[model samples]
Target: MASCIFCKIVKGEIPSFKLFESDKTLAFLDVQPLSRGHALVIPKHHGEKLTDIPDEYLTELLPVAKKLAIATGAVEYNILQNNGKGAHQEIGHVHVHMIPKPRPEQGLGIRWPTQPTEMDKLKELHEELAAKMQE
Candidate 1:
């Protein structure tokens, strides 16, 4: 937490183009943006993954994200939550990227390649996930 940029922003040690702030969360413009009003919504407390935060805390984040998305006049958007480095997470803290997809000219979407997978493999994964969810 001492080294986290988001924590620094929350503490006012680092300057951020702030959009919204609540007791439990903070939303701010991304310094390096993918779109005109790209923002990052993060928990005020240090949480490294979705599972690390309580359900109540996580649920509250959506409305704040929505408000920022609408305030920025985003025609379309993606709420991307990255968990860890293996999933392209650059920072250790949990933050949702509010990428405003205003136009194709901006090239801000769906670029990650997907490949077809076997149905049996999908079924196996689904079964495993379903079992885990029940725990």
Candidate 2:
């Protein structure tokens, strides 16, 4: 956490264009924005991933993101959060991106690689997950 940029931002060790802040969360303009009005919402708690954050710290995360989206006057946008490096999370902290999609070419563009649905495999997987959830 001492070396984390987000943690530094939260601590005012690194200056940021802060938009909103609460005890549990912080919203600021992204320095390397994907599009206009792009912002980063992060929990004040130092968490490497979603599951690492406490529930109390997470309570204001989405609400801050929603506020950022509305404040940006974004008609279309992407609320993005990635976990691991393979998932495209550059920072070692939990943060959500509110990227305003002003045009088709801008903001977060995603490609959904769809796979063929196999009912038997899907049922078996679902049952396994369901049983785990009960435990």
Off by over 4 Å in 1: none
RMSD of 2: 0.9
Give per-residue lDDT, candidate 2, residue 30: 98
Error of 2 at 107 (Å): 0.6
Local accuracy of candidate 2 as per-residue lDDT tens digits, 22-130: 8889999999999999999999999999999999998988888999899999999999999999999999999999999999999998999999999999999999999
Q: Pick by lDDT: which candidate is best?
A: 2
- How many collisions between residues are there in candidate 2? 0
Off by over 4 Å in 2: none
TM-score of each: 0.87, 0.96
Per-residue lDDT of candidate 1, residues 9-128 (tens digit): 999999998988888888999888988888989988788888888776676578888887889888798888888899888988889888888888661556668999999999999999
Backbone clashes under 3 angstroms, per model: 0, 0
**Ten-residue stretch with the least lDDT total in model 2:** 57-66
Q: Residue 134 deviation, candidate 2, in Å?
A: 2.7
Q: Best candidate per TM-score, number?
A: 2
Q: What would you estimate as the lDDT of candidate 1?
A: 0.85
